[model samples]
Target: MKNIKVKTLGAVLAVLAIANSHANETAEEQGEGMLFRSLFGDTLERTYGITVSGLLDIGFSRNNRSTSDERDDGLSNLPITGLSDEGLELGSLHLFVDKPLKANAIPRVTPLPGPKPETADFGFTIEALYGRNAQFSRTYGWDMGWDMNEEDNAKAKRDRLSFMSVPNLAATAYLPYGPGFTIMAGVFGPIIGYEIPPNIRLAPNPFASRTYAFVSNLTTVSGVLVGTRIMDGPHGLLGIELGIAQGWSNMRDNNDDKALLGALRWRTPDMNTWIDYEFMVGNQENESTRDIQAPTSRLISADGQLRQQHSLNGWHRFSEHWLLGMELVYGHQDGDGKPTTVDIVTGPGFDGAHWWGANAVVTYQIRPDLSFSVRGEHFSDPDGFTLFPTTTARGDFNAITAGFRYDLNHNVSIRPELRYDWFDAIEHDRPFGNGRDRTQLTATVQALVYF
Candidate 1:
């Protein structure tokens, strides 16, 4: 009887070992997954063959200006961006997915036969951001719905210092006919400037802070842009794009009239040098105050803000480790407005406003993972308009930025920047140091990690 009990125990142990082996085999067949995938869903890339990327940015900055300079509740110190009075905060966060395109070769797979003369390809980008930088990135209509009315999380309240914005959600289609034309629809960043936006990972800009000239850029546009290559050869490839948008930086139309925008681009076949001339023109102003009864001057003035801009920018890589880039912008708004902030001047002038600016940058690549960059910019806004929306006291805004880009690895980078801003041509009031000082100096260090 004891021998029979021992045999039974041995048989049970062998059966349990076989069951464990089968369980291991099943787990292997299911593919590798994160330890927490059982709780949270699997990653899109691992489950659906899609590509995903994300970035987290944080920084701390100290400006010469005092905390007394802050305005509008708990956020924003004029002329000082990226590193506002609220330092040591999340600067920007981005998570996106994209499939980029090749303009000329996307249609190469199409056969030349009578019936098979059509092959096509497409791509898309969906990007979103959250942090203090969203203040400058909000697209009207979409984000405006929440931001305009000063909803719960719209403004940078004292309790909540961060906000969110969707800068891009666009798609592109490449056609097979006639050297391959492309059509892009939805919201995208303005195609005029060399500087970067809150979407830092998508751009090669080396600066962590913004230049005064950046105020002239229109931020985002919602509409359709169509393009086709005009020339292709050893000299270069020239292309032209034409678009009609609701207006500058707006996902929803501000007026019934539409804005016309277009660009002409030229570059070397090797892409060593590139140049672009871009323009936008249309009426851009609020129409919510339109008086249906008698024609109010306020309504007429709001409709009269016909806005236009022209931008020319280019870059050339002169050497393996050195490059230079420049951008010039001009803008005009044909309407009347008033200054909300006043210091010394009794009467502010706002008959018409025309603004212009220029930016120049030099970069030296010190190593595969490090670079040094310097940029100088000057912008003039005689009567406000694009410089400061609520104030007609804008002036000749000048700034210089010096910074370094150091990458610790493929997914991590750090930037330390020093910036100085001064108003050479004072309009009505001083903008820094609680309306006391003429210049502002800021220093910042930031880190970025990617996933």
Candidate 2:
């Protein structure tokens, strides 16, 4: 896998050069005004800080079908035929660390104790994620008339190796009474060094299977989250927040299933806003009644499931240059034994399907180290067709992306990107026969660092 992603990116740049050489010898014996008041802090001992981040991505692409068939049954079945060339690519590598513990560093130049009230803090976040191509079946494509082949569909090839570690410990308690309130809690876990393929949406072509030992077996996911907030001043200067989460999967086989998530946010001092929701229930494997041809339907058994997801996002800055954003997502699935017809012609049986999407973005700084951006997205197909008829139908698809950014300082950053995709489907089966469409172009470059 590209020499194990270049020896895990040279061991994360040798641990970020030993944490920037111990933060530059602790900022030359704490000069620079007590090292910027101990990494940014001052009024009455409010001290807490830590940050380390990473991202590196590279890309190129062009397509139309048959590089041995890359599936996309709708949006006009287009799989860019046989190896159209481009070059070097690897994306998704993230490393994170963030810390803070109760803060309050003087300011108020004389507002008496009138406002200095809101308090409560605790924090932790540690993360590592690596991705190459990172599935979605190389951006959708797959079907091969069932009996799945190509080495069991090369587990949707996107060049593999998957590892993710997530740890977060949190706390927030500020509301010694009044307007600026707070109450938050946390717990997180997502340790998976390998074994991924619990059906990343039945890969037909999810970015060509991207590593993780070509999917499945080796798993761990643990969780707990809680939250509450209402701040506007007394240190927070802004307000609104809410959160919830519960999770478990193979945490020693507690019936092997569970999940739920919720979120909401709004902040101001500068600007911030947000919203989120999620739900999931699990158990899988049925592959259209295991292709029922009898023989006890090839020894039937394995297909217990229920899944759901909903998402919405928004961010606006309106100044300090400009920024605006939006996103919406919906999903669903339900399955449990008996209910065939190859599961309603492959839309996956007993009725229930949904998909809705929307996204828009605009950002501009032009200075402060340059910046620019644009984004768009649309997708639909929560069952408007395709429950078999030789499979492949569920909303035509549309996509667009653009970018530019540079900030070699204040942490670090670099970005260059372009993307375009299109698909449509009504019917013409034979792996999406006649009714097909194509259009693809991709280019990417990214680098980010923060500490």
Instruction: Report lDDT per candidate.
Output: 0.64, 0.38
lDDT by residue (13-69, candidate 1, tens digit) is 443344334335544322122112332444664554344555666677777775643
Give the C-alpha miss distance for residue 349 in model 2, angstroms.
Answer: 6.4
Candidate 2 lDDT over 271-299, as tens digits, reads 34433333333432233442432111111
User: What's the TM for model 2?
Assistant: 0.26
- Each candidate structure's TM-score, on Cα atoms with residue i matched to residue i, is 0.78, 0.26
Q: Pick the candidate with the highest TM-score.
A: 1
What's the CA RMSD of model 1 in angstroms?
12.9
Least accurate 10 contiguous residues by lDDT in model 1: 107-116
